[model samples]
Target chain A: MMDYKYIEQLLERYWQCETTLEEEQILRSFFHQGDVPEHLRQYNDIFNYESEAKSEHLSEDFKQKMIDLVEEDTAVEAKTITLSQRFAPLMKAAAIVAMALTIGNVAERAMRENSASEVAGAPVIADTYTRTEDVKATIKVIDQNQSAIMAKADSVKTMDLIDEQPEIIE
Target chain B: MKEISFKNDILPLGDLLFRLALRIVGGNRPEAEDIVQDTLIRLWENKEQLADINNIQSYAMTICRNLALDHKEKFENQNISLCETDHDRADDHDSPDKALIKKQQYETAEQIINQLPEKQRTLVQLRDIEGKNYQEMADITGLTLADVKVTLFRARQTLKEKLSRLAQ
Candidate 1:
């Protein structure tokens, strides 16, 4: 008993592309309610299909996959680093430590020989004090050199860590 | 300017883009899925440039459409025709015969729309299904408003003629 004249008019305009978006929506809504009169039943499929098509969507798994892909791309490094390249700074630090130990041991031996000679030659107090000062100066210079080498090694290690943080986070 | 978060802003457009891609690539789900994935990845990679864009959804649609067209061209042999059955659930109150008829009608409707050319089908998907305005369709499709109307008119006309015959 409902008048479908308005719907028929909208359908005509819809085919002509004269209906506004809202009017088109009204037509869709009308067909979606079902129970179309015999004359309107044929148009039912078109609106129903459009309505059903709107439900077509990518799954949540697909969404998660896409997010993982984007994150992976951002996490990966463009320039690949080999194992040797990664540990090169560590190798340099180890070498510096070994050289410093050797130098320290040699300096200790030289100081031991000098003190032994001084003791045997009836060393004067002033001369003994000067020899002690020279040994102290040599040890201090060695310590400063060692500290500088360790500082440089530490900075290089820090930089390497910074560069590798992205991979680590991934 | 509002900041664009990939999860919130870009990723939500996935379903919309997927639907568009599906229509463009002739209902090949895998191909359509690939197109959407590529489109999202491209958008995320170039998200820095997206901050200035007025409508990111429309912009994403454009990118998605172009990628779909390229993918279709590259694999011309595999652009299988759309024959997917509608997944729409039958109304619980409907009788079995009515349900089957409704299902067939929906399938026929899909077949009719799928028969349209790529441009016309895409325009139909955007306007009728996606409920996009003419201006938005023009912006997404790179067509003038008048051209959008004309193309949509032609597409709808074809649908009308075919549907009328179907009713008869």
Candidate 2:
């Protein structure tokens, strides 16, 4: 006969997440035997399922198919290796864009600071009319650059659209 | 890394995954088997990650549950509705007498559980059917211990309420 106290303690520990594998096995065995007490009958289905669920087996054909899937994935990865191997040009292009942006930002800031300092140093020496004309020329240059950037952005969008509407469906 | 043999390390979990899939998918053997296969492939891909895992079974359950939910979502998306007839069809194979008895119990029980959202069903399966502890459930689900307890309490209450209806 099983010790009811010990079994009860193990059940408590089972709920509390402290039971070992052997203790869990004991619970399953106790529950599996023909005569579960009235109170524990409700748990019989659950415990039996817990025990039997572990032994649920897959078919042999399924196992072979899984191995085939693994092989297929590996083969696909191998085939894609050359594509990733050609990423150096893309990496270089990204680096070039980054460097140009950094340099342009620094140059623009330095030029602005230099002009501000010059204006401060020679407050009234330079002709105000000449400075106004120079600012107008700068505004025209900025307008031209803005239109160029917008045109470039529009072309990129059109290219994206073309790619999305693939002519040949795989 | 050396190739992990399916027969040695992972195929054993197929039966566990199958039953779990059966319970979740409700006798849709093909879909459940697909999910089991997917879970095994996922484990093989992430085998390195398993070295840190204490319980492979719990890890596999998490994968299986996620895959099963994904399949259900896809099924719903495809307009493949889960009709009451789907389960009724399963009952058709049983003898009329046994079917009557089972139908009575199944209706009362399944109605209550079927009313539960998918998350609650998954939790009940892990805790009640699979006998996973709170911590193991917490680890597998990434849910807190309190969350597992509250969900489990609600699940058991649902079962209890339905089971009591039989006495009536």
TM-scores, one per candidate: 0.74, 0.51
Q: In candidate 1, which residue ranges exceed 4 Å CA deviation?
A: A79-170, B1-4, B85-96
Model 2 is docked with a DockQ of 0.16
- Per-candidate DockQ values are 0.62, 0.16
* CA lDDT of every candidate: 0.87, 0.68
Report the C-alpha lDDT of model 1 over A1-170, residue by residue, as the tens digit.
Answer: 98989999999999999999899888888889877899888788899888878888888999999888878887883878899999999999999999999999999999988987778455576688999998898777777766665776687866554333222121
Query: How far is B87's C-alpha from truth in model 2 (Å)?
Result: 14
Worst 10 residues of 2 chain B by lDDT: B81-90
lDDT: worst 10-residue window of model 2 chain A: A161-170
Error of 2 at A150 (Å): 99
The best candidate in terms of DockQ: 1
